[model samples]
Target: MSVSFPVSVRRLSAVAVAAASCVGAMALPASAAGPRHDAHRDQVAIGGVHSRSDRSLNGEWVEIRNNGRGDVNLSGWTLSDSQGHTYTFRRFWLDDRSTVRVHTGFGRDSSRDLYQNLRRAVWDERDTATLRDNRGRFIDATSWGYGRNDRSDDNRSHRNDRDDHHRDGGRRH
Candidate 1:
């Protein structure tokens, strides 16, 4: 049996299909659709980290940078380690194009330095540091020490153990 639609009906059906396809193509993932998809997410980044501090606990620190043009308020943002140790920011603002060192030990908070006020070390030689926005949305992460294949102590010496930056579109394995 052959049933042919009128030309107008056929054109309307084709238009509907095209519209549906366009809508589907434009749709973003749930994680990337809301306020969590911050505009400044890429502007802030994790910089160099001196994870190995032999002398003082305060010597161990992670550096964060605001690479954008305007100031960013890091009041509720959190910086966490692979071991689940987290440091929440108080009422603080990071100036544009500035870097701040977040130390592991106690110290007075300043424009350039923030303290976690912990008694012990939080970052390990082979660990990942993750930064999340106030809404708990992932912003950036940095991994150091060893790669997945070089987990064993014997392989650690062979690997470069350099810092690996995992940006928004990627993750630390």
Candidate 2:
């Protein structure tokens, strides 16, 4: 016995094979169709809290981490407190999945550390840390503890005890 098919059927089979190959390529785990953008690239965060008083500056540091797969060039990035005390980045490159500690006291800048050189504390127990790009574009912010955003304004009187101790007369960056 012999079997015969129309030209249209043959062309359709060829087209189907090509389409399947394309689909297979796309279904790959790591192909060109993979993620074009890093979702965690700009995911900068105020990681650890250092809102306490101590003689050493090490006890008063806020850490910023690059939680992405690619290294982030934070050359001109700025980390500003709610009181407008800003620490600008210079010649700093935060590597992928790494952290750089920003100390409140004077210190040297390194691949894993940066200093704010502030006589007083920078991170307040009731404050927000705003991170911005070089061009002043809003990137990320982390607010902690009781602050202006809290529901209880009456409890704000305690700001003098522990919260407001870090305010440096509303100095500008």
Candidate 3:
């Protein structure tokens, strides 16, 4: 034989269980949410492109800073663009009050500099760069020239540009 509760009782029990679960989740640390930004999100921010020279591709970069008093291990963090271009960190550490420049083109990796090794550009007149933790949780996101109707910076001279659509091969390259 089996025992069953009234429909109202069963509904009440389900609601109680759900509320308890939510409370428990809230009590846990941010890491319990699976890799979060926390304080590092605010410390690190991206800036605008000073200039985008067609050859060097040096102007296209993302800058991450550690404004806190301790070091930040970016071992598995990732930086990605609106077009899906991503740069993964490998054993990289940002010292206290220090900054790292992630360039779009090929270069040597160091404590202060990293490279995306892409043949083309990753940023454009209007694009967003997102930073994610090791677990792929969003940490921070920065956008420039977006939501603006200005096209004054559109050179319209580079080949394979495709208006920044195909600049990064349309994926993480």
Candidate 4:
């Protein structure tokens, strides 16, 4: 059977929020990291909005990086657009000090065939990514701009350099 609508937790009426310790997660702060943060430290950067695909495929995806020193469960979390639109999650399992890339449409209707066909309008370049806790609170959210290659808030991502988005802020994270 196939689902006709999005399978995001946004459809859920209400989900109880437990302690962060219960899930072994803390609030992620990109603001503290500032415009230029350290690449070595562990973090989970929530990316931005992708444009609708005319190809009628969905490669519109989100990026979640593990920028922390420990492993964290992405379960019971949600993502919100700068426009205030929200996408929720259920099982966001990640490894410690490792990064995981998820198709924002995962359970809703994510297929490799669909991803391969869809032109990725990634949330990477110009948008601010706000990651929330189980209660929908912010973990870490940032707008990757300035001191980096893109520098402008225009949603334009760097072509071939991960360092393009990574900055030292002339300080440490």
- Strongest candidate by TM-score: 1
Every model's TM-score: 0.65, 0.59, 0.61, 0.43
Clashes of each: 0, 0, 0, 10
Model 4, global lDDT: 0.45
lDDT of 4 by residue, 58-111 (tens): 545555666567566666776554555455555555555565434443234222
Q: Would you list the C-alpha lDDT of every candidate in the order shown?
A: 0.76, 0.66, 0.67, 0.45
lDDT of 1 at 34: 68
Q: Cα deviation in Å at residue 100, candidate 3?
A: 0.6
> What would the TM-score be for candidate 1 when compared with the true structure?
0.65
Q: Candidate 2, 151: how far from true, in Å?
A: 17
**Model 4: CA > 4 A from native:** 1-42, 47-57, 105-127, 144-173
- What is residue 30's positional error in candidate 2, in angstroms? 24
Write model 1 residue lDDT over 42-102, tens digit each, in one string.
7887876777577887888888899888898888999888778899999999999999999
**What is candidate 1's local distance difference test score?**
0.76
Whose lDDT is greatest here?
A: 1
